[model samples]
Target: MSERINDIMNEEPKRGRSAFQPLIYAILVVLGVYIGSNFSGNSTFTHRPAASENPNKLVNIINKIDEMYVDSVEKKALIEKAINAMLEDLDPHSYYISSEELASVQEPLQGNFEGIGVEFMIQKDTLVVVSPIQGGPSETAGIRAGDRIVEVDGEHIAGIGLTNSKVMEVLKGEKGTKVDLKIQRRGTDDILDFNITRDRIPIYSVVASTMVEPGVGYIKLTRFAKNSYEEFMMGMAKLDEAGAESIIFDLRGNGGGYLHVAIPMVEEFLEDDKLIVYTEGVNSPRSEYRSQRRGRYADKDVVILINSGSASASEIMAGALQDHDRSITVGRRSFGKGLVQDEIPLPDESALRLTVARYYTPTGRSIQRPYGEEIDYDNDYNDRYDSGELYSEEKIELNDSLKFTTPKGRIVYGGGGITPDVFVPIDTIGASWYFSDLSYAGTIRRYGFDYSDSHRDELSSYSDVESFLKGFKVTNVMMEGLFKAGEEDGYERDERAIAESGEVMKIRLKAHMAKNLFGDEAYYRALLEDDNVYDAALEVARNYKDYAIVDGELTLLSATEVEEAMTTN
Candidate 1:
């Protein structure tokens, strides 16, 4: 048997070994191989063929270690490690997912999860309800926003070092299962107890949508999940009913999901058969995704909002619109994540989410940035800040080699993410260490919940978001209470600092309160009414034709007619 095993393992060492070789050698040393002593005349040495005609050198080494080493080892674990190491040699986006993590990984993108739906946050060592999902099990069971959950299943969960994962473990379970909760309401004397039946709660991709102005609509898509297109269309339908002539499509912080979903959403803005995006790679041939169906929103003026957090499908949609001169993109340059990952399921129920292709815009520009160390790629946003790219358009450089002309003869550059036509610098005014410390300690969120709880009856009186937005104002008493909470949380009470951050804090707190009472729509309506990015986009929409694509950038046309001059020439 040993001799037969030796025959299976005898492969010559290849030139230039990979980075994983040393680790494989270490694993071999740690887990020595053991051969059975019961090798008799009846015992047959089964010689199985390698996975491929050209057997993997790494696999051969691992097999040799398993068969010839002196002690017992988990060959499965070693194989998983080897697979992970091999993928690291490829692009940063290419990664290995374990069987244990596969379900959790798919849950968000699938747009539904089994749980008693109540969005929560750990505030002051307690599980505070940010908001109950409308019509969800929690909300149906009388779980109001700002209610503090003290116990789960009669177990004392709060003030016992509870974490987000621990809370999820206690709350989330099989559908139709019961989970009891003991709540602490601000005004209630006794702890409120309720039993919530777990059910399939929808995870919405479009968090907020409303009419920002009479003729303009504001729709914020949180991600490009499976049902994102449906949610977006529903929102648009409502906007259309409200007489919307223009749309402010907010894609800020929407780290993308399904490409299929995004393509259809992009189609809504484009004409029939227009090339929205195309993908190609060494392995993947050029496949162009075009607008196939006639869209209802074809003639509507569009403005897309993006930031450093917006990526993948977000970039695809934005780039396509910009290249076609269909919309004005506002905000900072987007997060450059143009790689298209294809999830290949392994035999062990795990998955290999490998970067199979690079997506390009209509003008053929790749939005993917150069990848180095994984940490560096993750910290690229901070690097942008350090390099002054986040605050100034001049700091953002375009690669001349990657220049491509749109159909309208406007130049656009590739080599990185989608650069917005109008750049809104990050607001740093009134940002102090005092404000930072308080925010870091979750003081702002906690204060909002506390204030909402106390003012629920008064706040609940407002029937419409517009009425609430115009009528409500943060009082001195509420400000003092927020400041007191900050002080209690070890954040010093600097009256001058608080005054400096007063306006932002007031608006943000009011937004949070609105979110607690109504939903994300009210929250955004309150917050974005004064947001700089939204303001910029609104400005562009107000004077839509005054601005035109010139050279490679967005420029305002002079009062002296250039198009008339060109016609004469």
Candidate 2:
């Protein structure tokens, strides 16, 4: 044993290992001490420390807290907070989910949850049902879109400051459980009652899909979930049936989800053997996801719409498409988050979403913005806003040293998020103070709901969206009612601001009414007509070849010296 230790310490360093001599010695010293302490006459070497001698530091601190001169502390809550604080130091994306929060946190990504389904909003301290989820318990139990939930099991709940979670607590339950609701429905003299049985309600990822024009299909994807692929494929099939020759894939405000779902969905839009993304880490090997089969959707012109909120799996799709010149991306730069996490469960039913690997795009773009222990994670968006990057493409700072070129020779900027092929600045037109007040007071939503309820039969009369969009106008009477609602909510009307905002407000009002009658597809159909980003996306979709990236569009950190810097760095 002594001879073996001497041999290891005196071992000559390899040709390229001169720099590691000290580190190698330190490691050997520790190994020598460990082996010397455990080596017995037996062939195998092992050491089992006594339970008392091998105490965990965290448990020791916790035990000390219990015994110290402090009041009774909820150990579980403290531990959870400590775990969160520790993970916060690691990175913004790595997080801790307590047992109580675990299920709710996992619900959306899991694709469904057991509950009485109704999309709702709070207004005047009352819970107003925006829409009963199609085919869900509330919808099946005769709950309509305009109904206001006033009571639960005969107990008054309205006018008592209802919160989203409070409503969820009373409504969501295990399968087969029942909850009674008293609704103040529009056009009804008396309160309507419903006894709804809770069941597994699907949380759809593909929120909206429709033919935006004669040959263009628009699909709004909210997130990449377990069932997202199937939902997306169904949307694709809907577009195919509608004879769609081009697609506008909207991923604005999508925070992202499962990569597994995103990879498969993006693959259907790319040619065979195209690499979508690859993840690598110190422990994790390089894992590449590639398209296996060519689908009909690959031939169609596709435009990806992404805003700052689009991230993770959303970037995977946009990056892949832009890298391969399969599609053109519009909207602002995406929310850069290339870190891949793997949830590790602890004994207390809580879990830690630990960052395990970093994913790169097809052209070796990391897509992750710089992060550090001293950096304030919450100020990221504000910093971008303050820098004027959100409003101007020229304000964006591109690091040329981290740059790579795509297969089609388009300049690909790495390290940050996926920069759009064409930038669409944030729209501020018709954004008057009166509109802001109305939005804050929820006047538009309330008035739209009331109007839709009263005119339900007439609104439903239109069999197609084009007719409804063309015929349904925001009358003076409707505007008057909305103003009245705003005044009642303590937001007095400003004539000048109102004049400036009326057109935009009317468009939003039309969207809200469309949502109440015909769901998300109709809502987007009405809303996108007035959206600046959507307009840009539509043009890109119609003529992707013309709008495609060119060498002149690429920005660099130092244009004159990028070549020298790339080779040196």
Candidate 3:
């Protein structure tokens, strides 16, 4: 739901990248632009034809190239490359989108897209259905998990060097359009066929919601999409139903999406008319977005999880709440993204996403990291890593010139990413070179999918996540097989290394298997067994006041201050 700015961005490399990497790379690409879902509507002026065919500098140059080049040139490709160069020079965030790339770039953030609605993977030259998206056309049409898609529309797609793009080209179509698929099911002698009509399959932003503990609800929001506010509300309702007294809002690695989506989403946590965030730029006037109503969970303790991958709307959500001292933000500093973008449609369907404004937190904090004019914008992450910022909150550089104070008199700094109230350094407790080597060879994913696929009959016995957690265990035999897989991948077994990393490996193996068998929630539940940031959030949520910044220090508020904050909120 976040990080993909253009449809075909790093297309091949994207196949193996975690869903979290896009936002970081994307924010780095665009700087800090968050183009709203209603992109075309945000155009400040209509794209008009010039008096002459070749008017602008670039266009005139393109015309000259077309007129006198030694060989024929692709005018469209030329124009796109020129546009890319232009945007790359402007800032990190401003960029152009080709018409073909526009829809796919916006699909995940728009909340839905037309597709066959089966999550798939290209394994060993065959397209296998990982799971049918719930209530999707493929699911409704009876496509089952582990079904091998042999042919599409009578054309053999399997064993034909299939790529994600190739699969998308064939499977995704206009709603109500039927596509024929020949499938090879397990234990079935005959090939089965399913004619599935494509439909609007939802791309969920709230990836997981669960009662991590009694009276504690944890919602992992991956991005702020068009439906994210509604999705978050649904999550909150579920947690409330489960008797959750506190909330752990996990926005870790969330790259961010629609700005409007973020505003309303954060409005769910603030008092009426409280300044949530504001925007200002030289060309764009100052615009303030205030909370419209008293939020539903104003009095409930909230803990926000953030990290270097959290940017734009993720920063917005974290910054606003942190400014109000409404939540205890934990983990590393946020991905600094303070710019706002407005999408302008060009003469063609392609559009220009131009940065128009800079967003500021209520405390007047600019969460934009410095860039341009000798600044190594791309190397900022590396600099942070080298400077020990990830390992120590004290290492985060803050500017006193940009210092601001929250209404509660808590001193906060600006001009960098949001610094968490409680910091959880990168966990190195179980890290070792051996574990790194084992992980480098795809042992976890390979073992997980292969095991799940082979033991489907046994895994299907667990009716729910709770039962699976209780019933499933990574036995010694499974560990041996996993180690053997690592060895096959060229990682030699070091007894000391295995001793150090074996438990962590089991947790990952179990999580991946749970994800493949059950769903995303199960995967997160399995990994929560060893998550440091999550553990911090849980502890802080239960005793948030112990870490609350009152008078710029972690101290319990007096009875009068507590009553005032309660009344004000």
lDDT of each: 0.79, 0.77, 0.79
lDDT of 3 at 548: 47
Backbone clashes in candidate 2 total: 0
Q: Arrange candidates, best TM-score first.
A: 3, 1, 2
lDDT of 1 by residue, 1-569 (tens): 11000000011111234654665545432221211112222222122344653324434555777788677657666655655555666766676678987778777778888999999989768998888997799989989888899988878988888898898899999999998899988778999989999999899988887887788888999887778889999999999999888899999888777788888899998889999989898998998999998778989999999998888888888999989888888999988888887776655577667777888899889988888655566678789999999889999978989988877777778988888888899988767788788777778877887788777888888888888899999988888888899889888789888878888888878887887777888888888755889899888777766676666667867666557645667
Q: Against the hidden reference, what TM-scores do the models get?
A: 0.85, 0.84, 0.87
Q: Return the TM-score for candidate 3, rounded to 2 decimals.
A: 0.87
Q: Which stretches in model 3 have alpha-carbon errors above 4 Å?
A: 1-61, 432-442, 487-496, 548-551, 555-569
Give the runs in model 2 whose Cα sits over 4 Å from its true position: 1-58, 123-126, 188-193, 547-569
C-alpha RMSD of each candidate structure in angstroms: 8.3, 11.7, 6.8
- TM accuracy, model 2: 0.84
- Candidate 3, residue 66: the lDDT equals 65
Poorest 10 consecutive residues by lDDT, candidate 2 = 2-11
RMSD of 1: 8.3
Candidate 1 clashes between residue pairs 3 or more apart in a chain or in different chains? 32-69, 32-70, 32-71, 33-68, 33-69, 33-70
Best by TM-score: 3
**Which lDDT tens digits does candidate 3 get at residues 148-173?**
99999989998889999999999998
